[model samples]
Target: MTTYKAIKLIKRPEPGPVSPDIFEVTEKELPKAGSGEILIKQRQMSLDPAMFGWMSPDTESYIPPVELNTVMRSSGVGEVVESNHPDFEVGDRVMGMMGWQEYALSDGKGINKVQADVPDETVLSVFALPGLTATQGLLNVGKPKNGETLVVTGAAGSVGSIVGQIAKAEGLTVIGVVGSEEKANWIIDELGFDGAINYKTDDLRDQLTKLTPDGVDLYFENTGGPIQDLVVERMNAHGRVVVCGMIADYDKEVPSPGPSWVPVIKKRLTIQGFTMPDHFDQIPTLLQQLTPYVMSGKIKHRSHILEGLESAIEGLNMFFTGDNKGKLIVKL
Candidate 1:
């Protein structure tokens, strides 16, 4: 093909569901792999809550915002169709920041070869950003211990689900807070979470108190909502809180208030916020810690996939609505 389709950020998104007008779908001439570069035909791309931050006008975020009229930034799995890079070769599967396009040309700065014998969907859902985030936040930051209680918000989501499962495997009492009954059941029954609280239907304080009779020891914060304050209040002394994504307030004109620091002071808690970009250099080590759980059949994940590249525009709303069952991917 002489050209490929790509979506560019024409305008910054407002504080609500993403409007389609902010993105411009355009066709561009396909570029060849220049010297020491690789040409990748992206197979599937990941849709994450992090995209909201990337598209915003926030210049001080962990990573730079996507420049206006440039390809919307994202990560994806692709095949190296042509290559001049020494490490990458034609036909090799790879994953990296390929953006919101079908074809990407890389100088091999951030791209890495996919050596695992798993489907592309599995790679994006488990081994990519979601799994990496879970490992770094829960294992490294949370430092969960046996018999302790862990309450992870967005428990049915890409990162949260994996975090709960890893905690379960590590002998923690895993309780997940979800939005709907189906998600609650999936995390509790299928993913082996000790219990689940439906944030929309349940009394946050009551359910959390009943479920975590011993008090929570590790709090993996993925969604900052009303339940966030309740969970923090129930944390035991010396408890650790791993602050990941805050999806609940991502689209708000004014972000919601966080939990009070009184509990942190009284309980001697440690709260830390992390983003993947800061720990990208430690990917190899994180994978080593997370792989054993996957190999032992402890970690499980599902993909909520969109059909075409254009579908990504609407699929992002699923994060706010809690409509997606698991990891969100755009199959291009």
Candidate 2:
């Protein structure tokens, strides 16, 4: 049997100087698909900010820690080579919550059918999990209305960029917040947002006051911490704040706190945090609305596709440092 390389977490360490040494790659024999199982040859893997939180041993979280000597947790697109499941077939392209391995054996639990004809890069770009996350988080939760102001942090990212575009499609005045002027220009000029604020340079409160003169109606909160605090205070009456992922504090040893939201009571603001699983049933609906726009070129997306599975760590680092624009995916 031939063995393949996999990035595995060898230890869980406290936040310390030595923590960087906790993860390593190792060769492991590829296992055969058992009955009802499908074997996947991973082509591209997603490196998200949330994966950093899952590496910690102390925090109680949505997913468990990657056990010592186990492959790191990641969502990836793969081609099925062997299948014992009736619903899946050999040569089927799929995406799922798999580990950071060249090959994976799935029992048909987390895997979803991916559009094989789409460019291999696009599967991990806008059509797969990142797209769904943005679509579900923005359209379903945001419910942005025509002429209303929709604001999003991480505006250049896969989720936020789509959120901004979708809101624009719905006739909302989209205001995007990103870390760089280059990203700001891309969001405004390329993605059709009404305005883009370079959060790294601008004073968010004053900028929001000038840009969203009527106050924000829908705030798609992606990066939390100080930015979140500012958005909360600037929300209009009956404004909705959809807390997606908090990328800002994800890699921190100590999390940053936002301003007290008790004032939201008097302002009649609606603030809610959600994960994709909360509205799993909405996935098909989101796909129906988004896929057409994507196909027709009405909706567009970008990705930073670095080559090789070894680049996954670098992708994660880019995500943490806000260096990546659009979705960050590593090709295997």
Candidate 3:
């Protein structure tokens, strides 16, 4: 049997406080690939805020809680080391929900054979799940129009960063909301956002009103909380909101109270929550369309790369603390 190391959650540790050692690294034998299956050696893993919700012991989400003693769920880029599948070859480069392990065996299900020539980092970063979520949500849900006003929360993150730029490319006035002035400046100055607000200090209502005098036509919400409520208040009539994620309440025992935006629904607004898997069929279209923009320098990225699997805990913590400026990736 082939041996491999994986990061597993030993228990659902209490949310409030913890030691540095949150996850345990354990070695195990790689499962043998069956017919229609493949074995992969992981290269890099995407560290996402969604992991926070998945780690909790709950039934509220569509995804079930990660059971104790199992590899932590995550997406990664890997190379096929062995395959018994007709569609795949041994040297294929792939990206999928391979969990947090050095080696993973898959049945070639829920996996995509990434273009071999694509950069390894892009496979797990901009062109992976976050990129698809951003492009699809903006196009399908947001449905932005030229000269419209668009606002994105968690603007420096993997999803929000791309959403802002894509909206800008569509000729919308893009306004970003981030946790720090540095992030705000990066989005506004570097990424071509029309304006940015530091949500940590700025009065959301006041700043938004000043930034988007026309009111918001699209709300790409990566964070849900008081910011969501504030964004709803400023939304123009018949606006659309894509609920991409809710990173704020992941660690709390009781969920933070959702925004009191129901009254604003009278304006004929559309708000929807979505997962990337629900729209996986559109990935080819997404990649074909986005790759050009990315290569042309129309799309920009900021990533925080942590070294080694041992630092995964720290990298995960950065998501919670809003410390990461862009995509948080574990370079193994």
- For each candidate, the alpha-carbon lDDT, in order, equals 0.93, 0.80, 0.83
Mind giving the per-residue lDDT tens digits that candidate 2 earns over 1-332?
A: 89998988887745432344677978888899999999999988887766766777854676567787888998889899999999999999898787888999999886888863687668777777778888877777777888898889888988888888888888999999899999989998999998877877988778878888888889998887566777777778899999888877666688787767675986798787877755555666767877976887766778888788777755667865677766888888
The digit string of per-residue lDDT tens for model 3 on 231-254 reads: 888888898888889877666677
For this target, which candidate reaches the highest lDDT against the unseen true structure? 1
Off by over 4 Å in 1: none
lDDT of 1 by residue, 106-214 (tens): 9998887887788999999998999999999998888889999999999999999999999999899999999999999999889999999999999888999999999
Stretches off by above 4 angstroms in model 3 are 17-22
Clashing pairs in 3: none
- Work out the TM-score per prediction: 0.99, 0.93, 0.93
Better of 2 and 3 by lDDT: 3
By lDDT, the candidates rank as 1, 3, 2
Better candidate number, 1 or 3, judged by TM-score: 1
> In order, what is each prediction's RMSD in angstroms?
0.8, 2.0, 1.9
Error of 1 at 224 (Å): 0.5
